[model samples]
Structures are given as C-alpha cells and as structure tokens.
Target: QFVLPDANLGVIAFIRLAGIKADQLLKNCPKEYWVPGLTYMSEWSHQWLDYVTRTSGRLTKSVRFCDLGDFKMSMLEREVTRRDGEAMGVMEDCYPQLLQTVFLCNASSWIQVPWRLLRPIMPKRVTSKFEIISPETNVHERKMLLQYIDEENLPTRFGGKNAVWPVHFPLPEN
Candidate 1:
C-alpha cells in the first residue's frame, strides 16, 4: 500500500471508490505529520504495472525543496537556447524585470491571505502583513512577501501559486 501523509483530501475519496480501507492507512501515520492539505495517493490496482516498476521512499525532510532553482534555470536556459541567438538577446533584455514582477505578484498574494487568516489561528505569534502602499502592489509587495516567507522556511509552492498562508483549525473536543 502507498502511504502519503497530510495529503490532499481527494485521495480518501479516491480510495472509497475501489473498496480500499483509507482510514486504516491514515491511522498508521502520526497526526502532526499528516498534512491534510498536501497528501495525495492512488490505489495500487489502478496502475499496478507502473507501481511494480517504480520504487518508493519515505517522505523525509530532504524531499521538500528539490533543487527548484537549478530546475527552473535549466528550463529557462533550454527555452532561450531553442530560439535563435538574436531572439535570445532580445529576450534577455525584456524578460528578467517582467519575470521578477510576475513572481513578486504571486508571492505577494500568497503572503496576504495568510496574514489575514493566521491572526485568528495563532493570535500571539508575530504576523507578517502585506502592505499595498505602491501602485505596483502586484510587483513590490509580492517581492517583499516572498523574501519574508522564505526567511521563515514555510512551504511556498501550492500548484505553482505560493501557499505561504498558515491554516489553523481547532481540534474537536474529546
């Protein structure tokens, strides 16, 4: 059986369709490590052939930031090189600032939602607020927020959009 911790809720729904016991699998993992938002899994029967050929490993801390900078740079370099040398020169002039602005905007939005949400969850802890002081809220605020979240070592990528927001849900009374 393939186990995923704190995986997306969808996996549970998926297991139900195949008459597999999801609750038992979930019970095997510790409560704190089970990130309900991040976990995802598929039944062994659905793709048995692929499963037989593949190797699986435990989800350790090291698995989390998989050389993202190198991967991104490689992709960018490949795409640029695919174009003619003259085109690459033009792109070099036009891309860096524009790309930086886009990344900043996405990061800013990520930081803002958590700031508003986390206050109710962890009231006593320090909270980072995203200020929209500049006309370039999409650019400047986002860049600032990305830097702040990175320093805190929070998970940032949520399906290409940074999910820097912290989620807190109250536990059920025993």
Candidate 2:
C-alpha cells in the first residue's frame, strides 16, 4: 500500500477506487506557513475536506471561512498561500510513520546541533505551566521559535537508524 499524507492519501484512494490514475505531485509545491505542522494531524476529518479537494483536482468543494473570536480562517488561508500560491492540506494517518522513518534514517549529528544551539535562545520565562498561548500571542512566538529550531536541527536521511537530539528543559519546582 502507498503511504501518503492524509489529504493526499484520501484523495488518491477515492480516485483509485473510481478507476482513475491520480498522482499527487508536491515537487516545488507551495508550503502552508500559516498552519504549522498541520500535516502531522489526522487527514480523514471533515474539516480538511476543502483543502483535500483543492489540491487533488477537485476544486468545486465549498470553502467557508470561520472566525474563532480571535482569529479568522480566511486570514490564515491567505497566509498559507502567500509565499508560493499553495495552501496547507490535512494530515494523514501515515504521517507519524513517515516521521518515524525520517527520524531513523537521518544523521544524529545534524539533529543535535539545532537542539543544542536553540536552548539558549528559547525564552527563559516560558515555563511549562503557561503553554497555552495563542499563535498571535508572545507565547506563540516562542512556540514558533522552538518549532523552527527543531525543524532546522532535524536530520534528513534515506535509510539508517539515527539518534535524535535530547530536549533538556528544567522542571518547575514544586
């Protein structure tokens, strides 16, 4: 079976079942910057139906924008496609497996540098207790900072088990 991200996988499965040859070409495709790590989330949910449809040659699906009091989906959508004219797709079931494989094959040295270097840059005030800050808030800035460090620090490889960098954070005193 072909393992793919949820949005693409679902579309491919549907197309194949309908007797169509579908190729999900993502080469040089635009990245969805607004929704960070969305490809790591589940793909079979209804919320991502429009994204799946748009990317899989099915653009007729209705697209609605919702506001969550503080943020609007339209704004996020615009930001996603702002860089490369591409939007984010929903996550698939195989994403975790893909990450596991990626983690195993990449070089440990490449993974360790970012984690080690970023420790000093992370806000010292960001304790574990106040972790629910919005992406629009200062807390969100820290989250992005950490995510950027991790992504840049992770190693990319084809085939081999590699050790991941250790994340060291001081525990809160009781």
**lDDT of all predictions:** 0.27, 0.27
Per-model TM against the reference: 0.17, 0.19
Model 2 misplaced stretches (Cα beyond 4 Å):
1-25, 28-41, 45-106, 123-174
Backbone Cα, N, C clashes tallied per candidate: 8, 1
Candidate 2 residue-wise lDDT, 1-174, digit = tens: 111123342211101111111122223333443234333332333334445545677532211111122222223333324432222323223332111111111113433455457646777542221222222233433343233123232111111122332222222221
Runs in model 1 deviating more than 4 A are 1-122, 126-137, 145-174
Q: After superposition, how far is residue 11 of candidate 1 from its true place, in Å?
A: 26
Q: Please give the RMSD of candidate 2 to the true structure.
A: 19.3
In the range 14-95, model 1's lDDT, one tens digit per residue, is 1111222334434664444433212222122113212322423321110111112112212333322333244424433533
Compute the lDDT for candidate 1: 0.27
